[model samples]
Target: MSKPLFAILLGLSATGALAQTVPPPQIQVTATGIAKTSPDRVTVAYQVRGEGTTSDEATAKARDSAKAIRTGAEGLLRGDMELHASDFDIAPVRSRECNRDGYGQAQLSTGPCAILGYVVTMPVSIDTPRIADAGTLAGLIGRLGGLQVGVRGYWLSDDRPARQQAMRTALASAKAQAQLIAEGSGARLGRLLRVDDGTNRDMAIVVTGARARVTPPPPPPPAAPPIQIDLSPAPIRTNVNVTVVYAIDQ
Candidate 1:
C-alpha cells in the first residue's frame, strides 16, 4: 500500500478506539417534600393614632396613648409575655375644595386647600406563649380609647428541626424517583454523581380571630361591650426540593 493510504487507515483505527471509550449515560430527577406542624407562639399588634391641629400636639397625644398601652400591657405580661413598641409615624393631613366659575361652565378652581392638621400613629407588638390570654389583652386595649387591635395566630419559634425533617424526606423521594426511572429503562442505578439543593420555601400563616375598631358614637352607649379575641390554631408549612443525578450501570 502507498504511504498516504497507510496513514489514512491508522487515523480511522484511532477514531474507533476513542469512540468505544465513551462514558455511560446519567439520570437526573427532582422531588419535593412538605411538612406541616402547628405554631407554638402567638403575636398581637396594636395601633394608636392621634390627630391634632399641630404636629407636636398630634405626636404628644400619640405618645400618651402609647405609654398608657405599654403600662397596661406590662400588667398583663407573664413570664412568657413580651411587649414592645414597634413603629411610629407623623404626617400632615391635607384637604381639597373646589368652586364653579362665573360662566356656569362648572370650571372648578382650587377653593381652600391647606394643611388642616397633623396625624400621628404608633404601633405596638406583643408576643406571648400563653395563647389563652390573647382575648383578655384585646379586651383591655379595646377599652382604652384611640387604640386598635389586630391578632396573629400561631407561628413556629424555631424552624431548624422542621427543615431537617423536610430535607431527609426530599432526598428519599429523589432517590426513589431515580431508581424508578432506571428500572423502567432496563438499567440499575450505579452511584450518585451530582446533587443540587433546589428551592427551599418556608411560610407561616396567621389566622386572625378578631379585629376591633372603636368609633365614638353620637351618643356612645353607657359602656362598650367586651371584645372577644380568638386565635385559631394554624400550622406552618415547610417545603424542600432537591435534584439528584445518578449514574446508570452499563
Candidate 2:
C-alpha cells in the first residue's frame, strides 16, 4: 500500500529540519595587480639544411653551413652570449608513381619507391643576456646563407620575485576594499575566511620577423656593409588577481 500524502510530507519536513543551518556574514573582494620587469635574456633558434643525392654529401653541406654560422657569430659568443647546437637529422626525399587497375582503382608500383635525394638538418640556438644583439645576429645569419632564423622569446630568467610583488599588491588592495565595505555596513572586519590565488604563470614574450630563404645565396662583396635590423624588446609584464573572503563581526 502507498503511504499517505501527509505522512510523506511529514517525513520530508523532518529531514529538512535536521539539515537546516545558517551561514555567517562575510565580505568578498577581488583585486588585480600588475608589475613590469625588464627582460634579462633572449633566445634565438636557427635551422641549417642541405640537400644532395647522397646522404654523405647532404651531411657535408649541412656541416659546412653550420661552421659558417659559428664563424660569423664568433664575436658575439663571449660575455653572456652562448651558442648551442643540437644533433643533425637526415631524412630521405621520396617519390611515388601509380597507375589505374582494371577495376578502376589506383594501384601503386610493386617495387619500393625511388628516393630523389637526402636532406640533412641541424638546429642551433643562441642564448644571450645582451638583448640588443638579437637583431644584428639575425641579419648576419640571413646573409651567411643556408639557414633560416627564428626568435624563441624574450624572457625574465626568474619571475618569482615579480610574482611575489604582484601578489602582495593584490592582497593589499583586497584587504583595503574589504575593510571599507565592513565599516560602511556598521560591522567590524574579522579574520580572513578564504583566499583564492588566480595568478597566471604562463607568460611569454614572443618576437617575429627573423626568417631567411631556403636557397643559399653567395656572400656579399667586401665593399658592401652589413645590414642592421634593430629589435628593441619591450618589458615583460606580470598580472595577478586574487579573490579574498573576510568574516564580519556584527
Q: Best by lDDT, which number?
A: 2
Error of 2 at 3 (Å): 33
lDDT to native, each model: 0.72, 0.77
Per-residue CA lDDT of model 2 for 136-241, tens digit only, reads: 7777777776366877789988887787778788899999999999999999999998888754455453456988635333433323345766787888997888
Candidate 1 per-residue lDDT over residues 1-250, each given as its tens digit: 6998989999999998998998669998998877887777778788888889999999888888876665565555433567677677987665534222243334322334356789998877788776766776777676674366867566778776777777788889999999999999999998999777754454344555877644322322224444556656657898878888999996
Candidate 2: TM-score? Answer: 0.68
- Angstrom error of the Cα, residue 132, model 1: value is 4.4
Clashing residue pairs found in predicted model 1: none
TM-score of each: 0.67, 0.68
Q: Which candidate achieves the best TM-score against the true structure?
A: 2
Q: Give per-residue lDDT, candidate 2, residue 162.
A: 82
Model 2 CA RMSD to the hidden true structure, in angstroms: 10.5
